[model samples]
Target: MRARFIFSALATTLIGTAPALAQDDLSVDQVLGAWQKQKQIFHEAQSSGLGQTRGLKLIAVEGVDAAETAPQQGVSVTASTDAPTSTDTTPMDPNKPLVAATATTTTTTAPLVFGQLDPELQVNLQIKFGFDSAALADDQKPRLDKICQAMKLSDVQLFRIVGHTDTAGTDTYNERLSVLRAKEVARYLVEDCNITASRLETLGLGERFPLNQDDPRADENRRVEFQALS
Candidate 1:
């Protein structure tokens, strides 16, 4: 119930609705493209005075000619006659741009940014299980394989395997069933796909989140989903 309420609230709050991601099959390129766009938007929002800004006076390294790069507008840099010696003990790589810090100056530094994909991206897979059993169906293994392939290709390192069930049994029974199904999927991913166990978490939302809310008993309501953690 809580999960359903939260998701519904989020749907209402997010800017204009994003199209739902296709649930038929996993596509690595499509997922990555969406993530990249979201990441850019997240960073731009962070850079707008929301993150910490520190003005830094970049100094030239000794014997290294400093190539001047103009800072963003509204930012100013000042140099001091009493220049501090470079303390960077590490060997310099020729390919890297060189800069020395001398004093405290306020400059806009992008905040530590971590972006989450739009909720519409939560992948809904038709993972089947034997009747009244949590055991995964043999024929449905390929569906899980597709998910593994997508995850390996994606930059996301952690994922949550969320389980749901159709509204058929009691809430308690459905919840337990959902959890067992999710755990089975996670176990398969770890053992069969060589996915790190630590990188996966399982959640049993049970019938709390239904794809076809209008018809709670719809087969589509009984589904497994992938949510990126990081």
Candidate 2:
């Protein structure tokens, strides 16, 4: 009966200690694998992808050891220095003035001439449209002649003749009229002033962009603008 009692006590102790011994004997690789799984769960939870809620539940179960072991799985890890990398991205400056200091350089810097005009010529003409007879009175012919002469003297390259009209007429009628007026002016320049046909371009903007919106029918509304192009 005493021998039977001793055997019973030994059996109880073995049963209680078996699970603890098994846990202690777990291999390092197995421990690392468990850690990796926990890390994967934590990472999956942190990421924006699907199954995030399930991953969060797993992370709660496994804890941060799994996360700590994850980065060591694929490769050997190294400590990183805390210094930021410097980059030289700025362009070199030549230190020269943008606008050179010479009259020839300024004049040859491509004339502000568009089509066949210098914008400065608009000041003397008092008419924005270069060839709109309706905008400029018959008395202004001499002034136009003088302006054309000045353009010729300056060796201008190209002249652009743009025609505009007031909103007094229908869109279709005004468009045609504006185009015809611009063409007529271009013809006069070619025939009367001896300006080359190749040097001129005519455009008609019929009541499109009004200079004065308050009075679309104003005299200034019906005009032509000249642009000189080099």
Candidate 3:
């Protein structure tokens, strides 16, 4: 009952925004074979003269050059600087990603940026959260249990749990809700499923990549997706 109310309340509310990343992104031990093959499509689109023809933009938070937009109109700044730590206390730009002119990969080479990650990479889980709520819905334990069991296998190494939402609220509201839900789900896996925290990474893309773009209000669009990311 509470979940239903919370879900309905979401339509009128707005959530705050945070940095693009929730925490330090640790390097993956090994990239999954399937993911690598899927990633190849992105690389081809990048190298081809036609450019990232899929309308995808290169976005980075902080793995290489930390570029930020200035408050002044049309003013932007780019520089080679170290990624800031959580403990660093200083007035800085808000946690919006710096856009790059062209498509480029991150970390060991260029800055960490978004790639044309296939939507199929996102696993459809019945994970749902209410507005301004981080608590995982009580339903769908059997489905979640099967996912947890898969992660426990030896062959599977590291994975990412991503949160998404339907087009019901402000982008900021949905983004934060997604993050909170993803973090909470990660917490459950670590504490309840006995999975190592280091092996699981979490992120929230909000409503950017909905499963049912045609019907934005679809419940399946509001979900947590698990992908074997390296």
Candidate 4:
């Protein structure tokens, strides 16, 4: 009973001292104000020439206010000095080709109709087709030999093979016939002269672009020609 009485008295004394200790402690606002005053005094001393070098070392006095240094509302502020890294979770396939994750595509402007050729460099093939047929006649095949020879001799890299037709059939029929004729010439050049098919582009201008503008039905209007692109 005597020991319990002594322990209760010690506890009462500690509880009473706790409020007094808290009352003596500085608050956050008070600590900040004290720091601001120190800063002001340092600046004043410097401006007044009181802080001149007199062959003496300058010492900075630092003090910590327990209230300010203490954790406020159980929150902490810490700084991270390390750089962040990317963590991509995507799985890689060994069989598939590896490429950049982000790709950018660039679009180029297309060339004008008939791949627009220089009129001065135009080669008139004069290869004619049978009436109402896209098939090349036996006599017309020989004319392509000259074209293949010119292509081989010239430094041109690419050519546009354009097919034309006389105004004898409907627009649809003439268009189809002209396309077929252009493809036929391109095929012949590829097979006979060993020209790359990629180097040639076929276009069909049915009665639209003609050498003989005076008469649409003229045999001279029904022809195929080559135009250098590059």
Clash count per candidate: 5, 16, 2, 0
Runs in model 4 lying further than 4 Å from the true structure = 1-112, 115-121
**TM-scores for all predictions:** 0.56, 0.41, 0.53, 0.48
Determine which window of 10 residues in candidate 4 has minimal summed lDDT. 1-10
lDDT of 4 by residue, 1-230 (tens): 00000001111110111110110133334323332433343334345443432211122211211121111111111112232112321332323222111112232232221222222223455665555455555677776665666566654455556677888888767765676567667766776687766566555667665556567787767777654434
Could you give candidate 3's per-residue lDDT for residues 1-230 as a string of tens digits?
A: 00000011111112222212111121122223333443344445445632443422334423222121101111111111444232332222323322111112132333334332444333456554444556544574444675666567534445656677988998877765676466667767776788876566556667866667678778777777665533
- Badly placed stretches (over 4 Å) of model 3 are 1-112, 119-121
lDDT of each: 0.50, 0.37, 0.46, 0.44
Can you write out model 1's per-residue Cα lDDT over 5-107, one digit (the tens) per residue?
0100011111222334545644766656544443343344345422321211111112111111111111111122333233322322323322232223343
Angstrom error at residue 203, model 4? 0.4
- Tens digits of per-residue lDDT for model 2 on 1-230? 00000001111110111111111233334333333443343344335332223312211111111111111111111112222112221221223111101111111221111111111122112343333222223554454564355445543354445666889878756665565455545555665677776566555556763445677786666665554423
Query: Which predicted model would earn the best TM-score?
Result: 1
Name the lDDT of candidate 3: 0.46
lDDT of residue 147 for candidate 4: 65
Ranking by TM-score: 1, 3, 4, 2
Question: Which residue pairs show backbone clashes in model 3?
Answer: 15-173, 106-111
Worst 10 residues of 1 by lDDT: 1-10
lDDT of 1: 0.50
Candidate that would win on lDDT: 1
